[model samples]
Target: MWWGHPLVAVLTVWTRSAWGFSNGRVGVACGDMGPQHGPRPRPDPPPYSLSVDKPSFSPGEPVTVSLQALNGSFFRGFLIEARDSEDLQSPAVGVFSLSAPQQSQLLQCRSAVSHRTGSRKTHIQAVWRSDRNPPHSVQFLVTVVQDYQVYWVRITGPLVVLRGATESPSTAPPASPSSPAVLSAPFSSEGCGLTKSCLREPEGCRPDSDHRCVFLSFTADASGRSVMFELSGPAEGYVSFALSLDKWMGNDDVFLCVKDGGGVSIRAGYVSGRTQPELHPQESLWGGAWRLENGLIQCRFHRNSVLPPSFSFNHSLFVFLACGGAHGGSVLKHQEQPVVSGRQTVISGPPEDLRGSRPPLLIRLHGVLMLTAWMWTASCGVLAARHCKHLWSSRSRPGHTLWFQLHRTLMVLALVLTAVGFTLPFLYRRGWISCQRRDCDHEAQAGCRTGFLLAGSMQDSYSERDTHLTGPHIYGLPARQHTHLELPLKFQDTTLPDEMLVKIQITFLVKLLENSSFVMPPLLCVCPVSFSSVRVCVGLRSDGDVTHTHRLHSE
Candidate 1:
C-alpha cells in the first residue's frame, strides 16, 4: 500500500470481484497496491501483522518475511511490500521469492506478493533480499482481504534495520540539499552569444522578453570543469533537449524539465534509438532550480562537463529541442517536428549564435525547386513558344529552327527540375509523402499525371507529324503558312495542288477566303479566331481525264 502505482499498471479480479465489469481476469481497476473493493470501512484494521526472522541485515542478504493472522483467522487475498522507513511514499526496493508458492503469487510489483487465487489462507511466507541501493531501514506494509468486503490497506509492520546504520525508526529523514528546489525569477538571454552557448527558437528571442520562446543555454565555469544548463519552454507536460552525435536521434544524451503539479522535476536520460528515452537517477547535479508561471516551464542545473568517456567538454554534437504531452511522470511522443541545429556545437567552445529549422534540410530544398519549376520556368516556356516564335524566326541554329530550339530547351529544363524536386522528398522520408493540402489518396500518383500533361503539351507543339493533330483540327496548331505555298500534303491518297491546299487546308490568320463553292460560313468554333468556311475538293486525274470529283464540307 505504501508503494504506489509504477508504470504499465494492470489489475486482475476473479468472480464476484469483477462485478459490473467485463474481462473477469484482466480488468482496469487499481493503480496502487490496493484492491478495487469500492466502498470502504475506512480501511478496518486487518487482523494480521508482518514478522521478520532477523533484526539486522546487510546489502544483498536475504531476510525471511511472514504475513500471519494474529487472531487465527484466514484471508482470501493479500498484497505485501517493503518500503523505506525514511520516505514511506517511495516504491519498494528489492526482489521477492515465495517459500509457500501455492498460497500466493508475484505481481508486476516483482518485489512483493499478491493473490494467486481467492482461496483462504492463514499465513504466507516469502524471502525479500535487499538490493545494492537499499535504504538505511525498511518496514513491511500489507493489505489483507478478509473474505471480500472486509479488507485493510497499508497495515504497518515491524521495522527492519540495516546493520550499523545510524538511522533509528523514530528519527526523521534528513533534509537533502539536492531535493527539488524552486526559482522565483524568470530566465534571461542577456549573456547569450557572449558568455554562454545558447540555442533558441526564432533565432534571437530572449526568454525574459518573449514567453513563447523555447530556449536552452549552457555555460562552462572558469576552470571548464563543470557546466551550468538552463531550459525554458511553454508546455503543460514537459520540454526537453538531446545532444546527438549526428542529425538522427539515437544514442544521445537527453535531459528534461517535467512540470509536476506546481513545480518541476529535472531528469537525466539517454536514448537508444527512436524509442522513449530511458531515465536515470539524478544525483551528481547541484544548484538545481525550477519555476512554473504563465504557462511556461523553466529549470536550471549544474553537472560535470566531463561525463563518461563518450562525452567530453569539447565534443561537437547536434542539439534537438522537443516538447509534448505527459501523464503522471511518463512522456508522450512529440506532436510536431523538432528544431534541429544546422550544424553541431561544442558545449565548452566559445559562445556564439546558433541557427536551426524545424523541417529537415532535404524538405526545404524540395520546396525551392518545385516553386521555381511550376511558377516561373514552366509558365515562361509556354509563352515563349506561343508569342515569341516570330521574334526569332529570321535566325537559325545549326540544323534546327531557332525558335523551336529555344522553346524545347526551356521546357526541358522545367521538366528536369520538377522531377528532381519531387524525388528529393521521397529520398528524405524513405517513402512517398501524401500532400496534406488536399484530401488526395497520395502525392506521387497526382504529381505523375500533372507532369505527363505538361510534357504532352510541349511535345505536341513541336512535332508536326504527331497523328493526333493531323485529324483536320488545324486552327489549334502552333504554326503559320501563307497562300500560294506548297502545302505538301494529300487527302485520300490524292495530291492536292498548291492553290487548292491554301483554300481548304485552313483559314488564313488575318484574311477571309475568296468566293468559294458551297461555303459553310456559319460554323463557329470556341477559340480566339472565327472560321469563314471549311471545304475540300479532290479530282481523280487517272489517264489525264476528270474521271470523278469528290467534295467534303463542314455543313
Candidate 2:
C-alpha cells in the first residue's frame, strides 16, 4: 500500500518496514518512530606516552623515568609496566598504575645497572581498555649506556717526589721564565687518583742516576693508618727508602726505619749509632736503600700525651741513593776492607760466675799477709821475754853478751822466715804460680818429686794442728767399731757419814743400772751422724765408776 499522506492511508494496508523485515518470517506492520537515536558514544582517548629525564648513567649514579598519559578518556586507569632487556618475560617486571586524569609516574633507575657494560634498553608500556575493539598498549624505549670513569697515578722505578723542591712527574712543567715549578697531578689527602713519588725503587725498575736521586713523599692524615701508594714504571731490586721525621718533628726523631718484604720490621735507626762517649768517623747518618719488595715505607709516629690532632701532621719519605753504582759495588768494596781498630771484645761466660771469680785471688793474698803478721808478733814477744829474763839475772854482770847476740840473731832469723812465707802466697795470688818442667830423677825423695801441695787448710784448730794433716776419714776408733765405751768413776762423800753416803750411793747406782743394758751407746757409729742433736752424759759413782749416757733430741 502507498502511504503518501502520513497517517491518512495507514488503515488501508499493513506492510512490513525495512527495519522489521526478516527472511522467511511473517511481515508485521511498521510503526514510524521517526529519527530515533540512542545515547551518543564518547570520543576514544589517545594512547599513553613515557619519558625519562636521563637513561644513561655512570657508576654510582641515579636516573629517573616518568610515564605520561596522552589522552585522558582511554580508560578509567592505566597499568604501567617497565622491563629490562634481559627480563622482559619476568613476572617481577616493575609495574604500577595511574588513574584517569593522572598524567605521569616516576621510576628510579639505580646505578647498579652500570655494572653491565655496553648498551641496554628498558621497555616502558602502559595498558588501558578503551571503547575500541580490544585493550590498547603504548610503549617507549629507554636506552641505558654504561660509562665508567677511572683515574690513577703511579711512580715509575725509583723516582720519588723531591722535598723542598717542587719538581715532580705529577707536577706541571714550568711555563716560562716567570712560572715556578708546580706538581703535574693534583694533590689530595683522600679519594682515588692522588699520587706521589716513591721513596725507594720498586723491584725490576731501572736505576738511572736521575731516578735513584729522587724519592717519594707521602703525607698522611697523621692517623698512622697504613696506606697503599702505587709504584709503576720499570721494576727492580729491593727499593730502599727513608722517612724523614725531622721536618715534622725534629732531627733527633729522624730514624731510618725499614720493613722487610714479608711486612715485618727488619731494622730501624742508624745501625751503628750507639750511646757511647767516643765518636767513630766510620759512622755516617743512618740511612740506605733496601730491597725493592720493601718498597712500601710505613712510618709510625710515637703516640704521646702531647700529640697533635690526627689531621695536623703528615708522613714524608725520602730516597737514599746507593753508595756508588746501582749494582751495590760500594757495599761490596766496604766489606772487603780489613777492620783496623775499635773492635769490641766478646765476653762469653755467665755474668754472675764471672763476677764471683774476680775476687778470690785478692782475698787469698790478704789472708797470707795476715798469717805472716801474727807469726811476726809471736816471735817478737818471745824474744822480748827472753831479753827481760837475761837482764834480771845479769844485773850484777851489767850485761850478757851472748844473750844479746842470741836474741838479735833469733829476731833476724824469724823476720827472714816471715818475709819468705808472706811473699810465697803472692806468687799464686798474682797468677804467676806455675809448675816447673821436671826430668825423671829416681834419686829424689818420692814425695818431693811428686810436687808439694800448694793449697793448704787455712782454718784454725784448738789443738794447734793444721787441718790439712788430718785425713778426711779415719777408722779403728771405738765410735767406728762397737760405738760404745765404759767409764767407771767414784765420788767421795765428806758431808755425810760414811754409812749414810754408802747407802745413798748404792741406791742411786742400782736405779741407774736397771736400764743400762737397754740404753743406746754414747759413741754413735752411725755412718751419717747428726752432730746437731747428739748429746752425751756421764753419771759418776762414789767409787769413781762412770756410766755413759746418750740421747738424741730434736730442737
Candidate 3:
C-alpha cells in the first residue's frame, strides 16, 4: 500500500529537496537495498593526499598543511588558496605558494576566517606544478565546530623552579575517567612586590595600588575537558583571564569576562597584536560558562581552544590573571607567568623530547665559552685602562694592580678561548645539520633545527613584524647615561634558580655599555658570573660615567 504512485512521488520530491540533488541524477533512498539501485558508484581516487597537523582550529590560528605525492610522480611546487565556498565568485581568504619540494613538505598558513560567521565551511585547494609534467590539483575541506573544552594551562618562570624536580611532559596528569585533576600552586606577592605596591611602575601590570596579594588553585575535570579555577585575593570589581598565544605582549589574545554568582554566561573573544578583543555574543564559539562561589571567582572554558594554533604543543604559553573594571575599562593588577620554557618549567614529554627541547648542549656550551672569552678580553681592557699609570710607573706599583702582566696574560687566554669556543658549536653540525638518536626522533629533531636556522635567517623580518604593536604596553627604552662601563658576570655555566634572571640583568648591562659614549666593541665585551663568590671594583670618569669596572669571582 505504501509503495503506490502518489506516496512514492511525494517521498522522492522530499528526498531531493532535503539533499539538494538534481532530478537528473540517480539517488539512493534510505533503507532501500533493492536490486535496481545496484551499487553506488565509487568516485575516482584523488591524485594526492592533503592533511593538516591539528584535529581542528580557531580563526586567526596558524595551521600546517602537509602535501604528499601519491602517484608515481612528485610535485615540484604548489599554489594554494583557502576559500569559503566553491562558487567561482567567492573570494579566497588568502593565497600562498610553495617552492620546489622533496616529495612531501609541510607549509604554514594563518586562517583569516571570521569567528562571527556561524558554521561556515572552509575549502583549501592546491594546484601542484612542475617543469616537465602537467599541473595537478587537489582540494581539502575543514569544518568549523563549537569548542566545548577549555584548557587551563599553568605557566611558571625559571625563578619558581628552585627545587631540582624534573618538570618533563611525562609528569602531566594522566587521563582518568574517575577523578578531577587538582593543582594547588602557591604564588606570593610580598608587601612591596611588583604587581601590588609598584603597580604604576613601568614593569607593573597596572597603575592601581589597590590590588592585594593573591593565591590561586584550579581543578580540571577528567581528560582536561573542563576546568574550575578559584582565585583568593582582594579581587574586587572585574576579574579578567587573558590568554597570550603568540608573543609575550601582543599576538592572538583571548579574554574572559567575570561577573557575579553566574554573570552572563562565560564569554571569550580573540584579538591580534594590540587590538582590543572583539567580545560579542552573536559571533563567539566559546561558551564562556563561569560562576563565583564562596568569594572565589570560578570560570571554565573550552580547553582545546587553549592549545597553540599550530604544531607547537610545548610552546610556552603566557596566562595573565588581572583585575579590571566590570566593563573592561583597564586592568588594575595582574600576574603573568610562562608555563613551558624548554629549559626550566618543563611540562613533561619523552626524555628524548626533553633533550631536544633544549638547544643542542654543544650550542649552549659554545655560548658559555664564547662569553667567557669575551668577558676575559673586556676585563683585561678595563684593568689596563684603570692601571695605565701604574703599568708605566717608574717606581714599583700598587698592591691591587696585577702590574699589567695579569692583564696581558688574560688577553692571551681570552683569544685562545674565543677560538676554541667559536669552533665547538660547529663541530656537530657537519657541513649541514645532523640528526642524532640521543637528541630526538628524526623528524622532530630535523624540524627543530630547521626552524631555528629559518628563524635566525628571518630575524630582521620577525623584528619588523613585531614593531607595529597595538596593545597597551608599558615597557620603554632606558634613560640615557653620560658615561658607562658595564662589567658582566664571569663563568656563567651553572644550574641555579636565579641564574637566568642574573643573565638577563647582565645582558641589559651589556646593551647599556654598547649604547654608552665609550664605544667598546659590544660583542667582545661579554662576561659571566658564578653565585656565592664575587668582587667588583668601579672607576669613574670625569663625565660621571663608570669608565672601568672589574668583578672578580671564583666558583
lDDT of each model, Cα atoms only? 0.64, 0.26, 0.34
How many steric clashes between backbone atoms does each model show?
0, 38, 23
Ranking by lDDT: 1, 3, 2
| lDDT for each residue of candidate 3 in 163-255, tens digit (9 for 90 to 100) | 223333211233331222222332222432311211111232221222343322233334333333333333444454444452233443444
Give the best candidate by TM-score.
1
Model 3 RMSD in Å is 25.7
Summarize candidate 1's per-residue lDDT along 235-274 as a digit string, tens digits.
8799998888888666778888887766787887777666
Best by lDDT: 1
Better of 1 and 3 by lDDT: 1
Model 2 misplaced regions, further than 4 Å: 1-194, 197-214, 217-266, 270-555
**What stretches of model 1 exceed 4 Å from their correct place?**
1-179, 260-263, 282-287, 325-337, 349-361, 389-401, 427-555
In model 2, state the lDDT of residue 196: 27
TM-score of each: 0.46, 0.14, 0.27
The residue-by-residue lDDT of candidate 2 on 218-336, one tens digit each, is: 32323232222222111222222222222111111212222233321222232212121111111111112222321322222221111111111223222222211123211111111
Better of 1 and 2 by lDDT: 1
Error of 2 at 197 (Å): 5.8
